[model samples]
Target: MAQFPPVPDTLNYIFCNTPADFHNAVWVLRHHPYLILDCEGHDLGRAGGCVTLVCVGTPLAEHIFLFDVISPHLSRYDIDALLNLFNDRNILKVVWDGRMDYLELWSTYGVSLENVLDLQVAEVVSRGVVRGEGEIQRMKRLQQSYISTQVSDRLGARLDGLHAVIGLQRCWKECGFPAGNGKDPAVVKMHKSIGSRMWVERPLTEQLLQYAAKDILLIGILYAQFSKQGWIPRLPSDYYYLLGQCQRYVSAHREQGKSAAVDAFKPCQIMPLDVLDHPVGPKYRCNACHRYLSLATYETVQGVAPRQASTSEVPRITTLRRPRCRLCQILALRAGFRMDQTYLVT
Candidate 1:
């Protein structure tokens, strides 16, 4: 028989379904200022799908608690406390690729996730990758780059398509955390095959429980490493702002399912107008929508453009040109207005 490591005693894997267990988990979480969050849901494509499990991992306590939101044993108070944690601004909630999690949480709980720090978003901003480069900037790639320095290219490439934390377990192991108690490659492949159906399984197996706990545990470790590397400070201010906007956009889309609103929520960058002025090219791409447009699409501000001298005797004069596109400006204004309304209502 192949020998495997024992589950670490330091990791408290609490499954909260009863009031006592739920309250105990909440109490432990209240003391921690930061938490790594991940959600598991079923029927993801339909409106009926809801957040089934919420995993909260605290690095300080070295504990990961799994909350059974759909379990019949849970009471309204237990659910309310869990939702309150998501809304708490004092506790920084860290997630990797939180778009679907945010949407599902809003759809199921009618609560907004506040003070969120997305590791995937931070990774993109740190790399300074151009927008629309989704194929390259994936969570597994980020994990391999930042956490698992020893992973081979072939294995890392294979893990790119997987959406689970099992892909990053090696990274956690390298970081000295016991992450792969039940996450062998064969087991991970089995779990991935089931996809969203894991939520429907009753009397959750120990392997599944370990898998859920490890997701947030790895997130917590990656967050610490990111902070140590000073990547957190290097992230642009708009990234944080965009996270909130994204949550709102998800909420709005879930409620209304409008394409226009979702499109408006697309990530955008505001660069200085001078960066857009290329002598060789007349067309420029909008930093927000990533759309290439003519000069007419942009709104001109009174700014100095480089002037060419006609002759040796002629002196150069500065000219004005449109710096920012009009569509982005409109979208920004609308987003701000919507944010203001959300604040007032909240």
Candidate 2:
């Protein structure tokens, strides 16, 4: 029921905590072909964590609605209507790194998001991972010449290996979005100072709420940009493939409990389908990614052991093994997961 002054940006936002506001929000949201989505909370996507605010922005950042889930202002019927909107297959939902948001929504409120396009996934897929030294150099030069210098640094570092996930803030900057308070260094510092605790605080600071709104606004802009640049897939098969990756990303941590560390290694995001499903050859199933990939996808490693089975009491000595694919190995290594290796087969 509390209303704050409009954020100093073009988008208009409403804090929808009361039942009447929620009703109007759902009605307006249903008319859009796609909605920009993001969520804010304290340690969300983990057990004991909660989603405090769900930011939904209309296309082109016209209007943003802050659905306050922390407040018990809406009835079950109102909640169900919003849930239906999320689950609707006809309507698209644009997001940036929506894994945690998806987990929190489903785990906390039983709301499963469908028909989603994650821009983070799109960004990674746009520049498919390459391994050869010549290819890496060529790609780096190409990106630097076409995109901004910062983007070259942002993306070039991972050309020889798996893709590193880009944060939404940097992603916004990389896309050449207009400068505003949202991208201000001082505001970013203030957000870091507040950290995860601010979302749980009742009557959140107007600045913090505005910060949340601006995130979805950027997401909308990124969606439009990616679409216009043909970064998003247009073909039916390619589009569905991207969508499947987005779904896989959200489901990766479904069984994981609350932990202090965010899992930086998502197989789908690290090595997208575009990178994995090519150069058709004899296939072997990877123990980690669980995909039947070509032999080139793997690296020969010696003295590597598979995860030990709990039921067996006898110790199984580590042996030369090639359990996971190359991309999975890179992901595990970057995430500080322990691995034993010999060398790349090729």
Candidate 3:
């Protein structure tokens, strides 16, 4: 069996359900400058689905509180106190992929998560950064690890795909953490088998609770490691750029109908915006993805037009363009169906 990242046994995990428990949890949680956050639910962030668990871990994974918002014993006030932490800019909420969590929080409780740092975005952005290693060598290793050479031979083709979002488990392994007892294969296998029911099923088993705790633990550890290596963006401009990206991710789901699923895996889904923000040729809207993408994202052909003829008597040059971005084009080829090109221009 493959090794799993070790979670320390000494990790303090509290399942807060009753009023007193929630009150105590909130008091302790608010004291932290930053908290690692994760959520589990049945079809969470979607119509007909609801958030079942909210996991918050202190820095260094000292104490992890599993807040049971669905518990009848906990009043709205207790839940609100905990959610106030989400709105507090003074307390940072470090998350892996927080899109659904943000959307569900707003749609269900009217809370807008503030001071968020999405680690998934940080990981994608880190591919472009080289700390101690030589730039060329570091990029090569990153490409080998995270990107598919078949995608494109272009340098850093990995940056172009929203599919590059790395899951927390893979991120944990990549960070070089050792296998621990909490990562026992049986426990993991059981958790996956539970699927959506894992969160909604009352009286969550110890194995499931530990699984939830592991997520926040991983988030906290990743933030610490990324911070030490300077992977998390800290400059005012870069910071806001990331914040905007996180907000955009959440907003993508806001207007979505209850049954409508946000297809995160679609090639046309948004990638980190900064990667495509380069100053280059004017962007053209992809007929498939409907996103304004740079020239590099499409297939181009040169053509001569009599109307565009230059004053020097050269035929006016024009480029025949493809209807879709390269990524979406490939997807259409494999999927054997094309999405409607109709989209309102923003």
**TM-score against truth, every candidate:** 0.56, 0.70, 0.70
Model 2, 93-175: lDDT tens digits are: 99888878888878877778888888887877676432233556555544443333453454333334444566676666666
How do all the candidates rank in terms of lDDT, highest first? Answer: 3, 2, 1
Model 3 residue 233 lDDT? Answer: 70
Q: What is the lDDT of candidate 2?
A: 0.67
lDDT of each: 0.57, 0.67, 0.68
RMSD of 3: 6.5
Off by over 4 Å in 3: 1-6, 131-163, 179-184, 234-237, 257-334, 339-346
- How large an RMSD does model 1 have? 13.3
Query: What value does the lDDT take at residue 51 in candidate 1?
Result: 73
How does candidate 1 score on lDDT? 0.57
Q: Is candidate 2 or candidate 3 better by lDDT?
A: 3
Winner of 1 and 2 under TM-score: 2
Q: Please, what are the lDDT tens digits per residue for candidate 1 over residues 1-346?
A: 2222245534558888887888888888888878888987674424456677889888632888999888898778778887899889788888865656776776666777778877654544444333344644454453444324333242343333222222246544544555445245554787568656777677787767777776776677677765665546545665455455334323323433212324553422222122212223466565454545455445433433333566455443333333334434544554543211110000
Off by over 4 Å in 1: 1-11, 43-46, 129-184, 234-346
Residue-level lDDT of model 3, residues 1-346, one tens digit each, is: 3233455664569999998998898899888788989898887666677898999988877899999999989788889989999989888888977877886788889888888888877776677653443455444543455444553354244234333465676777777766443255666675568657667879997877878887777787778788766787768887677666655544443434233344432322234332424425777776544566667666656766545344667656677556666556555544546533432221
Angstrom error of the Cα, residue 194, model 2: value is 3.8
